[model samples]
Target: MYRSNVLVCGGTGCTSSNSELIIQRLKEEIAAKGLEQEVNVIRTGCFGLCALGPIMIVYPEGAFYSMVKPDDVPEIVEEHLLKGRIVKRLLYQETVVENSNSVKSLNHTPFYEKQHRVALRNCGVINPEDIDEYIAVDGYQALGKVLTEMTPQDVIDVITKSGLRGRGGAGFPTGRKWLFAAQNQADQKYVCCNADEGDPGAFMDRSILEGDPHAVLEAMAIAGYAIGASQGYIYVRAEYPIAVKRLQIAIDQAREYGLLGKHIFDTDFNFDIELRLGAGAFVCGEETALMTSIEGKRGEPRPRPPFPALKGLFGKPTILNNVETYANVAQIILKGADWFASMGTEKSKGTKVFALGGKIKHTGLVEVPMGTTLREIVEEIGGGVPDGHTFKAAQTGGPSGGCIPASQMDVPIDYDNLIAIGSMMGSGGLIVMDDTTCMVDIAKFFLEFTVDESCGKCTPCRVGTRRLLEILNKITSGNGTLEDIDRLEELCNYLKENSLCALGQTAPNPVLSTLHYFRDEYIAHVTEKRCPAGACKALTNYYILEDKCKGCTLCARNCPVGAISGTVKKPHVIDTSKCIKCGACMEKCKFNAIVKR
Candidate 1:
């Protein structure tokens, strides 16, 4: 056995930052130094503290290395691997706590301190491709327990007591959804996992599948046994190639171990799973549309009253939950219900994972308790807004959710609290914004995404969202009138009232929320024909600050249009008539002289 193992992050975030090359170089360096027998190299999934990647942790000492580069390999090898000395320089800044001698492990970091990872339990801890490693963690033990010790009704009771709900936008009770399928007297029953994570900056579900594929399989089998279904399907987008490949490997591994297929765990529980690839339609995130596509039909949403729990997947009794939701199942069964319920807020009992993104300093995956204040997430954990900019507002739940303005920063975040303020806990996409962000433009961007993603199932969503986009575009372009703003508001309500599905109905949220929170910016856009943030090109003009202008010809030379005129060592005047407001002068100016107003 090797004396020491160097584990490098293999998640997409760290991989992009050159963690793969570090692994290769570490192996080479160790081999070159003849320490292969003494030193081991490994590549693992995200360690949660994603900003510190490319991360390398040396075992035995558990020396946590942050921002490691390829060139730093030899020193690490010679010093740490060869001489058994800890490389202090490569260690994370937060390695030591403020008032403690114990080095802060990834678990103790403030970024992970509040997070109780039930669903994400195995992620970053184990290599997903290794089946033996999964087994070591009692991977299929939950499935075995369910099949051998529990009845169909018992499975439902455990889950119901666990207080688990769908993590895929709609927070329907998971146990209740499964019960509907079990109670329906049908010759054929089905189970589906909605792996079609279509939210624009959301990757929580994908990361779980990529890091812990076995968890989902175990949970699905448990679901199958509960619902009396022999056949199960995982409807995942084709975009997630890595997750897909690992899932396929996991399925093969499960079958080989008799955890799936006929008489699972040697009980008369027969169940199997199939993978259905989607052609990348955002609207297919809806359960009905996903099931329809699974049946080799056109992908579009169908109206629900007979929700997927009762009538889904070819009019059979079906149960559907997203990847993250299923990821929580086996753990809940294994850990007990009160253990799961004890973590989160009163209304929302369980930890929530967020794809922490946008203007924040720490951009990565963060799972926190339900009632954690936005201030704690943005300020302390997120390292505050980058460059000391003041926080403005945050957009949660992707295009279907609304913006939470600065005034509401102290509100405890949970499903009900967010929705109370006109936002919903949609698959957990939290995008932080700062002073520079234009709420009008931000809303317009989400509206634009919804317009393209609408399934055209109904006129209100298809035509109505497009019209809303047009009004937002007109306002940003300095062409919208007061009447246009009124018309936009009317359409937002109409779409909310008449759309056939959630995707269509909530499409106008960004438009409505931005108008509510940042009406001053909207009025500036419409009344004065000016974009306060200078994000709207038509409403902005670029000016060269006379005091700071170096007049190096950088600005004038880089101007796409020859609108900037000046000589060396002199301030330039922008010919507004010829200016396209492209901000080329601002970008090329080294002296910080360009200003937009």
Candidate 2:
């Protein structure tokens, strides 16, 4: 055994940030110091604290190193590994206790304190590529237990008791879905895991797959057993190349170990899984669309009622659940339903994993109890709005969800509570926005995404969303009237009532929610002809604050359009007509003279 094991993040976030180079450098440094045998460097998955990547953790001591660079690796290896001294400088600030030498555990950090990581339990703790490592952490044990001991009905009962709802936006009861498929008598049945995470700022599913691929595979196997299905498919987006590679590796490893294929655990039940790559279509995230895509047809949602449980995946019975939903299955089996049920609120049991992003200090993955308040997530866990900016609103559920204004920050974040407050707990993308964000522009941004992603299967989603975009555009461009606002509301209701799929039905959420909460901003854009937050480019103008101008001619020199005209040592005047509002002058200015209004 090695004296020290250095764990470096190998997830997509860190990989993009050159964590691989840090691993290479760590190895080179250890070898150069003649301590290769003593020090072991292992590339693992996302630690959830993505903002501090490329992250490195020294085991035995468990010193969490954040934002590590290649150059810093040598000193870390030399001091931490060889000399047995912790690198205090590179340590995550949260890990280092203030006014004391003793550091708190990673779980005790503010970012992770409120979290109860059921799905993400093995994520940062294990190497996803190695089957033995997964087994060491009791990964496939749940599947083993289900196959050997529990009956299909018993398994379904456990899931039902757990109160685990689908994490894929709809909040459908997972056990009820499984029971429906189980009760259906079909010659062929299938289990599908929707890894086609298409939310704007969501990466919860991607992170889970990358960090703990075995969990999903094992869960799929269990799901297959529970629903009497022999074949399974994981419909993942092609964009998640890292998650795909790791999942394939995990599958191969499981098969080699006699965990998959015929006679698994020497039982009569035979279950197998396949990978179906999606073309990165946002609409394909819908269950019907995902199954339709798997069948080599155009990705589009079919009419529901004869849901996937009765007829799906080639007109056979199928059960579909997203990556995050499946990630919880194995743990629930091993730990018991009550263990999972005890954490969350009465209605929405079990923890919820959110891809905490946008304007937040800790922009990463967070899994907290269902009843955890929004204020706790935003202020404590997310480290509040970044740069001392006050929290204004948080956009949850991407295009299909609504914004939670500061007034409702204390609302308990559960499915019913979120829906009651005019927002649904969609795929758990919580994008924190500061006071600087314009609510109208934020709504328009989501509308733009939904409009572009509409499958056009029906006129309501295709043509209707386009009209909504037109109104948003008109308002943002300073040409909107009060009548246009009424037209927007009317069009939104039409899309919600008549759209072909959930994609269109919920497409108006962002627009509708913003209107409900921040209607004043909309009125300002139409009546006052101003973007209240100064975000809309057409309604905003950059002005040179005379008192702050140093008369250095910096603004004039940097102006790409030559909009500013002034002599050196005199205040510059900007020709508003010529100005493009590029903010180049503000960036180049030594004195804070240029201000957007």
Candidate 3:
């Protein structure tokens, strides 16, 4: 047995930061120091603290290292591994005690203390490429138990009792969907997994796939048994090369071990799974659209008089759950319904995984119980917003969700509460905004995305979203009037009511939410012809604060257009007509001289 194991993050964030090179250098150094046998170097998935990647954790001691460089490998190997000395400088600052100079466990850090990981339990813990490591951690136990001991209805009953809903945007009841598919009489029903993950600031589903693909496969097999289907399909976007590769490996390994193919676990039940790659269409995240893409047709949503549970892929009864939703299945089966149900609120049970990002410290993945407050997530878990910026608003659920203002920070984050407060618990993407963020611009950004991604199958989505974007563009460009603002509100309601699919139905959410919470900013844009946050280029102009300017000739020197004119050691003035509003001069100014208003 090895005396020490060094686990390096192999997730996408760390990989892009050259964690692989760090791993290679680590092995080389270990070998050079003759510590190869005593030290094991393994590549694992994301540790949920992505900002400080490439992350390294030395186990047994559980020494957490952040932002490791390739050049630091030799020093780490010689001092920490070979000589039994800890590299205090490389340690995550939070993991180091203040006075004692002692290193603490990563779990004790503020970032992870409040988190309750259920779907992400296996992430950062196991080597995702290795199936044996997964089995050691009781990977297939849930499927085995279901096949050996439980009937199909028993499995469904447990899931139904667990109070689990789909982690995908809609928040539909998972067990009820399964029961509907199971009750249907079909010769060739199908089970499909949605891994498209099209949300802009979201990566929860992709991380789950890259970290614990077997969980999804096992869960799908269990689902196939429940729904009486022999065939399963995972419709994943091709952009996730790592997740896709690992999923294929997991499938092959499961089949080799008799966990996936005919008569799995020595039972009469037979099931198998396949993969279908999407071209990264955002609308395919909708269930019917995903099934359409899987069926080799254009990815577009169909009417929902008969949902997928009634008639789906290949015109047969089907059930589709996103990656994060399926990741919870095996755990619920193994741990029992009460075990899962006991963690969350009365209505929303079990922990939810969120891709925490935008203007926040500790920006990464967090899994919190359903009833946790937005304040808890933003302040306690997220380490609050960085750079001493005051929290302004939070945008959840991507384009489909609305904003929650700072006033509602104390509200419990759940399906119903978010909806009540004009936001929805979307696919678990929580984007925090600082005081500097323009709420009107934020609304426009999401509207632009929706307009670009609309499938055009419905006139309301295709035409109405474009009109909404046009009005937002007009407002931000300082050409809008109060009538335009009223028209925006009216058109948003129209799209919500007349849209064909969820893509259109929820397209107006961002606008509606911002209008409710930050309408003052919107009114300022139209009525006063100004951007309150100084974010809109057309509504703002640059000026050199005369008193604050030291006139080091820095602003004038750095200005690409020579907008500033002044001598050394004197105040500078900006030629506003010549200024491009690039903010380059402000960024370069040592003194806080330049202001945009």
Each model's Cα RMSD: 2.1, 1.2, 0.9
Candidate 1 — which pairs collide? Answer: none
Q: Per-residue CA lDDT of candidate 2, range 432-471, in tens?
A: 8887799889988998898889988999999999899999
| Distance from true location, Cα of 490 in model 2, Å | 0.7
TM-score of 1: 0.96
Clashing pairs in 2: none
Model 3 lDDT tens row, 394-489: 999999999999999999999999999998988999999998899999999999999899999999999999999999999999999899989999
Query: Per-model C-alpha lDDT, please?
Result: 0.86, 0.91, 0.93
Candidate 1 positional error at 448, Å: 1.3
Reference-based TM-score of each model: 0.96, 0.98, 0.99
Which ten-residue region of model 2 has the weakest summed lDDT? 95-104
Candidate 3 residue runs with Cα over 4 Å from true position: 98-102
Candidate 2 lDDT at 434 equals: 83
| Top of the candidates by TM-score | 3
Q: How much is 219 displaced in model 1, in angstroms?
A: 0.6
Rank by lDDT, highest first: 3, 2, 1
